[model samples]
Target: MSAKTATARPDTSKPPKKGSLHHVVQVHYLFTLPILIMYLVFFIVPMFMGIFYSFTDWSGLSSQFNFVGFDNYGKIFQDDDFINALLFNLKYTVALVIGTLVVSLILALLMNQKIPFRTGFRSIFFFPAVLSGITVGLIWNELFLKVVPVFGQTLGIDILSKSMLGNATTAFWAVLIVNLWQGCATPTVLLIAGLQSVPKDLYEAATIDGANAWQRFKAITVPFLLPIINIVIITTTKAGLTIFDYIKALTDGGPNKATRAVGLLIYNDAMQGGKFSYAVAESMILFILVAIVSFFTIKGTSNKEAGDA
Candidate 1:
């Protein structure tokens, strides 16, 4: 019989300390607390308060307010201007989204190619994005008022002197055109960045696979750029919904409120008309509409991403 010695086994069965997890959680909370607090203060709290005010008869300036309980919301639905403004805003949002995406995509593709003066072209494309909406509106107003007439005179057309914003139909189209022109630049820049980030090797591989130009673009470029495209769509949609400056400067909800957006209507109700609670209700409704539309849009995009993956 030999003496058997048992080797000391390594301690592999010890449980992790609860204190370690607690410390990690504490560290994460510490890092995230400031952002959470800021969001609550700036966004969450204000949003809830707005919702509350939407149900009240608060005149915005007065400290006293009465709870009206959905009457304001009911009035918003009944108001013809609110209905028209909502419709106009919807039309504008749809047109702007489609126009901006189409134009930006085309510009991005062109700029991605081995073209001369690419830097200059890019600067020209993106320059409008840096300008304030009010500035863009003012500049375009002058162009429509002055430059168009001069051009029209050179071409011998008298109709060019007519104010675009003076007619209901014309004012709507004018706002849409101005929005598309000024807004396309940012998305163009974003799409260009997305395009550049796509691997060149993927295109080469597609070419090797006998893929045509359109096929390569459809399969490779678009798929790779879908994430950025979603971002651009969300951003542009929100911007379109919240647009106030250009509309204020250009039409001021004129032509019998033909070009008035929900934002403008809300402003008119609150400041111009002194229907503060009603404006809050209108704002809340607009906010909900925006949130619902955006949610659906994002969900659809996310589903596409999942399917692609």
Candidate 2:
């Protein structure tokens, strides 16, 4: 064949088929469509409806309501129950964050060590996480009411001689203990995973450089675990602020409403008291509060993470 006759054909032939990006994206949307619809119907719609009603005088039983402007917002600040519940939630949330952080981190450290039956120990520690909150609350309620008192009496310990739930002063701590016991389980697991992820060579080098346990932890372990700790903080804060199930099953917001959380208060106002609009307003305030706290927490943690990096 003459070279001139073999002029190369332009590679206008179709390129090898890979895959359609559009098809993948469409498949993902298809998979998520049902969940998106459910979220819209269950959460987003109700949330907007609640916001709308918060500005109105809807009794929730009647179809008719009149817009009251900022009246509900004004009333929220002046309401003693709302104020008390807010304070209690603040206190509870702080304790939960601190307690969960300390307890879980400690347990994670311990569990990370080489020991006999480490897996079994981890399983034992993690058992609480799998239990239903309501079930655990109910079980703990009985213990507080029944078993704890016997131990208290036998030991002559005045604090536990009666159900901690029965005393306003002790009720907060009682709730905290149960929550910490249950709440720490997941965080501990997370921290253990985080601990395992820390490079052994880094620890060895730190030790070689004469860095003690605390120094190595501060310089290495904490930096690595910051993200997980941030998660723990956010979750525990939300749980503390929106506490209802535990309070409901354990204390019922009793002992003169000492443990009446905003969640419980909102429920009472909306369901039993029939202040539906009022409750909606309270809930909106709560939403704002949670948003504010979460915003600050995330911001602070991001700054720390960035600084560490």
Which is the leading candidate under TM-score? Answer: 2
Cα shift from native, residue 79, model 1 (Å): 0.6
lDDT of 1: 0.84
Q: Model 2: per-residue lDDT, tens digit, 193-245?
A: 98998989999999999999999999999999998899899989999999998
Clashing pairs for model 2 are none
User: On residues 175-254, what C-alpha lDDT tens digit does candidate 1 reach at each position?
Assistant: 87788888899899989998998889999998999999999999998997887788788888887888798888888888
Q: Which parts of model 2 have CA positions greater than 4 angstroms off?
A: 1-33, 301-309
Residue 62, candidate 2: alpha-carbon lDDT? 82
TM-score per prediction, in order, is: 0.82, 0.88
Q: How does model 2 fare in lDDT?
A: 0.91
What lDDT is reached at residue 7 by model 2? 43
Top-scoring candidate (lDDT) = 2
